[model samples]
Target: MAKTNYQELVFDITRLIPPGRVCSYGAIADYLALGSARMVGWALRNSFIHDGIPAHRVVNSKGELSGRAHFNPPSLMQQLLEAEGVKVENDRVVNFKEVFWHPEELGW
Candidate 1:
C-alpha cells in the first residue's frame, strides 16, 4: 500500500476506538497486518494534528500513554482520555483491560 494509504488506514482504525476506551499501537498495527507498532506510532505522530483521528486513544501495550509526548503540553492525551471517563494515573490507564478496545473483537 502507498504510504498515505497506510496512514489513512491507521487513522480509520483509530477512529473506531469509542469514547472512554483505548487501544494500543500494536493492536492497530496487528489489526491491519502491518506487523509494526512503530509504524502505527509514526502515522499517529504525523497525523495527530489533523482533526477526527483521536490519536490520544491509542497507547502502548502496557496501557501507558507512550505517545503522550507527541501531544502538545505532553499531557493532553491523558487529559483527553480522562475527560472521556478513562482513568489515568502515572501516565498509564487505570483498569486498562476493562476499558481496552480490541480491533479484532470489534465487529467493525
Candidate 2:
C-alpha cells in the first residue's frame, strides 16, 4: 500500500470530527502515530489551500486556541467554531469536556 502524506492524514482526521465537536492537535497526532503535536499544527497550517482541512475544529489538549494564528483573517477560526455552537471565551473553548471529540471515544 502507498503511504499517505501528512496533509492527507490531517484532512482524514479533520473529516472524522463531527460538527459541534472538536479534536486537539495532540489527539490527532497521537492517533496517527505522527512525530508530535506540533507536526499536526504544521499540517493544519498548510492545509488551508491544498486541503479543506477543518482546521477551525482543532484545538489544544485543553481546548485552547493553539492554531489561532493559522486562520486566514486571524479570528476567523474562532468565529467559525463559535458559529458551530462551540462556546469560545478568551480564545479558548468554554466547555472542553462537552465538546471534546477524540477518535477512540467514537470508536474511530
* TM-scores of all predicted structures: 0.92, 0.90
Q: Model 2: clashing residue pairs?
A: none
| Candidate 2 residue 19 C-alpha distance from true site, Å | 1.0
| Each candidate: RMSD | 2.2, 1.8
Q: Say which candidate scores most in TM-score.
A: 1
The 10 consecutive residues of candidate 1 with the worst lDDT sum are 1-10
Model 1 TM-score? 0.92
Maximum-lDDT candidate: 1
| Distance from true location, Cα of 32 in model 1, Å | 0.3
lDDT tens string, model 2, 1-108?
134787678778888898889999999889888768888888788877865568899999988987888787879989999889999999899999999998777575
lDDT of 1: 0.91
